[model samples]
Target: MSGRQTSFLAQALQQGAGALRSRQFDLAERIAGDILKSNRTDRNAVLILAHALVGQDRAGEAIAPLERIARRSDDGEVETLLGALLCKSGRAADGIAQLRRTIARRPPYLPSFQELAGQLSKAGQLGEAISVIESGLALVPESVDLKVDLGRLLHESNEFAKALEVLTIARDAAPGRPDVLIELGRVLILSGDYTAAADAFRHVLAQRPDDGSVRAYLATCLLEQGERDAGEAALRAVMRGGPHLLGRAAFVMAASSHGRFFFDMSEATKFLGGKST
Candidate 1:
């Protein structure tokens, strides 16, 4: 391409990418289509077009553009994006196979494993999701991402003991990791070990003192263990916090008054279930 043409294409690419990021999917699609018309083989333009289509709730339309790039580019990003698109578009089995193939071809592949596990879990293939994450962990034993994801999946499947084991390993692997600690505390809470869970929550609070959710969790542990005064104090502190914290506090307050506070830690603390605004 001529200098001016290349410059123009680059500018178009930048604009399209920015538009996609800003959720101006229609504008992004227009720019990406223009770029692809000038150069059908432009991988980035194809990717942008695919993304815009998917953003616009036309994930079905994204397949062609993604496949076009995949046919010519051996890039991992293309494979991952294509596989995830396939999964989101209701071709989960094909997506799972492709993601597995990508992982097999390259050990410790991050995106493929993450995407495959998430899709499998969402599709109710709990065993497959666990297997995928286990395979990734085997390849990268120290990967906090793989371990945490596995733990959370185990938790979702109601395998609290197994989830606790995995999360403990992840916590030991990286003691300073807040997410691992949080999951660990949650599993402990669900396991009927309120004291141990409270200790874990305290450890996390030491790390992230301002986390109102964690504070609420600590309060729950204390309350369950018959420390009413301390729990109510902690909850009152949450009520005095910012908007999100106040919402959580209100949830707990209302749940307590309504006798709905008997839910297990997962149900009680889940932002989804309580959904405090």
Candidate 2:
């Protein structure tokens, strides 16, 4: 392209990006479409259009534009995104294949591994999901996100010991990370170590004081340890935190070892009021 044409395209890309950042999906889509009309293979234009479509809840429509770029470009990020969009558009097998190809081509690209493992897990291929994450860790040993994911996958597979070990490494690598702490807390709970679980949850609460879900988990740990009074107080506090917190607290309660179920505030109130539902 000539200097003037290149300059024009650059300006148009800038405008589209600004529109996207400002959440003006319609304007961004229009700007990207105008750029693509001049050069359909333009990477920036394709990405902008894809993002705009996704922002408008038209994710499936973004797939064709992304695929157009993928055909001409070996860009790992683009292909990884295309793979995710394909999965979201109900083409999981094709998406998984695309992600595997991307990872084979760009082994160090983290998103390909993450996306592939996520898709595999969702497809009930849990073993492969674990292997994919382990392979990613081999390539990027210092990736906290990969470690956290591996830990979660192991936990889901009922490999609590392995999950706890992986999460411990992740916690050490990323001290004060809320996600790592939260996962560690959950693994500890499932491992039948309520004290350690409560400690882990406390660390997360120290970081996120208003987190009712963490509070609920902490209460479960306390109750498991026979600290009924403290646990009840925490549950009551979560109940008073409005509907969202109350629902989350109830979910945690039902999922934990206590096996309690609370459908609404009134039910929760009745249980804590000594009716013990």
Per-candidate TM-scores read 0.75, 0.85
* Stretches of candidate 2 exceeding 4 Å from the true structure: 1-15, 18-22, 251-267, 270-277
Candidate 2 lDDT over residue span 175-213, tens digit each: 889999999999999899999889999999888877878
**Highest TM-score scorer:** 2
In model 1, the worst 10-residue window by lDDT is 268-277
Candidate 1 residues 39-129, lDDT tens each? 8878999889989998889988888777777788566777888899888888988887778777776645687888888988888999889
Which numbered prediction scores highest in lDDT against the true structure? 2
As a whole number from 0 to 100, the lDDT of residue 234 in candidate 2 is 77
RMSD each, Å:
5.6, 3.6
CA error at residue 90 for candidate 1, angstroms: 2.5
